[model samples]
Target: MRYRALLAFLAAIVAGLMVVSLLVGPAGVGPVAGIAALVDGKGALGLVMREIRLPRALLGAMVGGALGVSGAAMQGFLRNPLAEPGLIGISSSSALGAVIALQSGFAAVSVLALPGAALAGAVVAVALILMLAGPRGPSLTLILAGVAISALAGSFTSLVLNLSPNPFAVTEIVFWMLGSLSDRSMQHVAMAAPFMAVGALLLAPLGRGLDALTLGEDAAEAMGVRLTRLRLMLVLGTAALVGSAVAVAGAIGFVGLVVPHILRPFVGARPSRLLAASALGGAAMLLSADIAVRIIAPERDLKLGVLTAIIGAPFFLHLIWRTRGQIA
Candidate 1:
């Protein structure tokens, strides 16, 4: 009963924020006006509501939920409090693919080029991780493999930036790295949603396996849990969610790390309960941040990723501070 109530409350927060996100844009449309325009879809205001604000709001919720759930799943699978989605290198690799597309001028050829390249990169990274980790390798092996992939991808991205000759391309790449939802279309929402939905399906059922894992591997296996399959699903699902999100939003940081951490206690530290709650909390956090960026600097083009980093970095430091004793 208590858990159900908590889910309801979080869902309510997400819903409220979604509405606020649609209404609170640069156009300054009121609640009633935004709703009417959204429904009517006839005039300029209607176009703005349908084409611009709607997708932005939808992506905000979707991206946030993806990152949040991915983070929670990673932490649960690894049995580590600090685990996050990006630790597996999917986000960086996706960024690398996008960078390659932009640098090579492929992104200009088609609307799907950017995200397609990003997803391809994520797939390569995951394949490499799996190969390096091996099917029966321990959690430590997976961590090391992911770290290696992340460093390699980061270096490659930097190399692309350093060698690029076009000043315009460089500038565009830099801004894209910072991330934003401005100027996003429904096409982007469509591109990312199916992957996120599939990823969610892959992950949502892992609750029981993850809960069994809390008792340790041998015990979990004894209880009919298949550790090998669990690991594979976790990697693929995380890749799908984080890959699709980064493909659309660029490299928004700390969402996966922060949301799950904040909501863990509320869910009694159970991976099963944490997944859903974290998803809701994440959506609220991102939507609120998106709205805040517009309000705080309406004149300036504030990047969503930059704002999240600013908010997340301090919290990350605080987390480290609190866990210092444990680290030592």
Candidate 2:
């Protein structure tokens, strides 16, 4: 009953935020008029509500949910509270792909090129991670492989940025790298939603496996939890989630890391319960951040990723401070 009530409360918060997200734009539409315009779909207000705010709100929720659940699964699998979705290099690799697309003018050629390239990069990184980790490798191996891939991808992205001759392209790349939901359309929602749904499906059944994993691998294996299968599903699902999110929204940081950490205590530190709660918490966090950016600097195009980093970096430091004794 308690868990259900918690979920219900989080869901209510998410729904309320979604509504606030739709209403809190530069246009300053009232709640009733904006919602009515959304339903009617007839005039300029309808277009603004449907095309601009709706997709931004939806993507904010989807991206936050994906990052939240991915972070929860990684931390659960690794038995490390510091584990994050980007720890596996998917986000970096996706960013690298988007950079390549922009540098090569492929992104300008078509609406889908950037996302397609980003997805391709994520697939390649996943393949590399799996290959390097091997099917039966331990968690340490996965961590090392992911670190290596992230380093390599980051270097490549820097190289592209350094060599690019087009100033306009450089500005676009920089802005995209910073991440934002401004000017996004329904096409992005259509592109990313299916992949996020697939990732959700893969991650949904992981509650039991993750719970069993808390008992250590040998014990978990003895109890019918297939460690190999669990790792594989986790990698694939996280890749899909992070890949699709980065493809559309660029690399928004610390969401996966912060959301799960904040909600874990509320869920009694159970990986199983943390999954759903973190998803909802993440949506609320991102939506709130998005709204904050709009309100704090309505005229200045504040980047969502920058705002999240500002919020998350200090929390990260605080977490490290608290865990310093454990680290030593």
Candidate 3:
């Protein structure tokens, strides 16, 4: 009953947030105006609502779902709830790829440059981590390798920005790093949706493997789970999801981290249940954060990542404190 109530509440919140995302923005589109525009031959309002707000909100759902499920997968596979896409360097590497594309002027040529570079970077990051950490290796070692990769990728991005002759690289990098759902178009959504959807399909079935993995790799292998194949699939799938997300929304952190952790208690630490629940929780959290970003500063507007980090950082510390004696 408690879980059902919580789920219902979350559902309500997400639905309300999505509506808010559609209605509220720079243009004054109130409920009546929005509805009239939708049903009647209104001015630019309906187009704005459809082309801009609709796609942005949809992308938010996808990206959040991707992050949440990926986080669940990472935690379930490692039996460590703290694992996240950012911590594993996939996001940073994807950002580096994006930066490379922008700096090389490919991003300016077409939107494909951005996602293409990002996906390639994501694939590279996962491949490098696999090599460095070894196939089906220690979770801790895998995490450490991820950290090193993040550091390297971050430095590379910084170096690229510094070296780029384009004077706008600094501000552009800031926007990309800060993360935003505003000003997004349907084209961006079209570019990333396939990768995100495909990645989800690839990772969803691995939930059972993740459940078996909680019993230790030896036990999982004894149960006939293919550790090597599972690891490869996880790495690739996470890269695809994280890459598409970062490619579009930039490095919006902690959705993956927070959602799964928040729902883990309800799901009883079971990986399979946790994955879908986290996806729902993540979508709720992200959509809510996005709505908050709009209303919190109706004048100048805050970036989505700013809201997420402000909220997520404190929760992160609390998590570290709470989980201190357990995982660390």
TM-scores for all predictions: 0.97, 0.97, 0.90
- Give the alpha carbon lDDT tens digit for every residue of 209-319 in model 2: 899888988888899998898899899999999999999889999999988887876888889998888888888888888888999999999999999999988988887
The worst-scoring run of ten residues by lDDT in candidate 1 lies at: 318-327
Candidate 1 per-residue lDDT over residues 92-150, each given as its tens digit: 99999999999999999887899889999999999999999987789999999999999
The candidate, 1 or 3, that scores higher on lDDT is: 1
Model 1 alpha-carbon miss at residue 76, Å: 0.4
lDDT of 1 at 97: 98
Ranking by lDDT: 1, 2, 3
Model 3 residue 58 lDDT?
84
Give Cα-based local distance difference scores for all models.
0.92, 0.91, 0.84
Clashing pairs in 2: none
lDDT of 1: 0.92
Encode model 3's per-residue lDDT on 284-316: one tens digit a residue: 888888888888897775899889989998998
The model with the greatest lDDT is 1
Candidates 2 and 3: which is better by TM-score? 2
> What overall lDDT, based on C-alpha atoms, would model 3 receive against the true structure?
0.84
